[model samples]
Target: MEISGSAFNSGLNAIQAGQRRVDQAATEIASNTLPQAPVETPPAQQVNPSPSGAANTQADLAESLVALNVGKTEVQAGAKVVETADEVLGTLIDTRA
Candidate 1:
């Protein structure tokens, strides 16, 4: 019994995708955890273009949460692909024996 090239390639791709997802999640977590720099305001300019620094922080937190969820989903899907590939290979080996 011989393994097809496509299956081998797919397994590699799945592993790479899973690693990428994990890396992305770590990066997002680190960046979100860092303290944000204080916004500068001039005494003469009373009006601010944005609502407030707090609002920006809230938005960043929301975006980070979304990214984390997406990253978790991607990693899970990739793991599944790799698991399926391993199972198929194992079955092939069993049959050969």
Candidate 2:
């Protein structure tokens, strides 16, 4: 029972952590998409921004996307842990009875 309780707690914690990661990645993706240029900036300047800045944004976006996928996987794993814990507890109970 104690072990199952611990596992359930661990699963819940993992699920929460994954949810946080998902939220952060989503926010980053939203903020990074199609950044707005200043109104006063010339059309030619807007067309050709600094190479380093553009590269950085692309890298950040890629990282965020990866984080999103990782978060999804974590959530799935956490759910499995919780399920297995529940099954173990059930088996123990049945055996004792």
Candidate 3:
């Protein structure tokens, strides 16, 4: 049994459409929104700006502040881990020699 060209194309189209719908639904459910790939970020959503650029600026500032705090936390955690490892290595060397 062989399918014609048009039938094959229609089947492929249905498969593609199903895949897109699944992708969209997955995005909506995860991460408050899922951007399929982190390397290609979605553009920021635009809010009304006739009179409230201040609010937008403030929001951007707030997002930066939170991000900065998270970065600081990770740095602190990494430092602690490195420090512990250094101390262990020093002790091992002292005991070996």
TM per prediction: 0.64, 0.84, 0.44
How would you order the candidates by lDDT, starting with the best? Answer: 2, 1, 3
1-97, model 2: which lDDT tens digit per residue?
7789999999999999999999999999999996677458776668656578778999999999999999999999999999999999999999999
Off by over 4 Å in 3: 1-49
Per-model C-alpha RMSD: 3.1, 3.5, 22.5
Candidate 2 overall lDDT versus native = 0.91
* Local accuracy of candidate 3 as per-residue lDDT tens digits, 1-97: 1223344444455445545544544443353333445343345644432547546655655665555455455445545555555666677678889
What TM-score does structure 1 among the candidates reach? Answer: 0.64
Q: What is residue 48's positional error in candidate 3, in angstroms?
A: 6.0
lDDT of 1 by residue, 1-97 (tens): 2454465566567667756766776687677678778767786786766568568767876776776677667666666766776788788778999
TM-score (C-alpha) between model 2 and the true structure: 0.84
Best by the lDDT measure: 2
| Clash count, candidate 3 | 0
Which lDDT value does model 2 have at 78? 93
lDDT to native, each model: 0.69, 0.91, 0.50
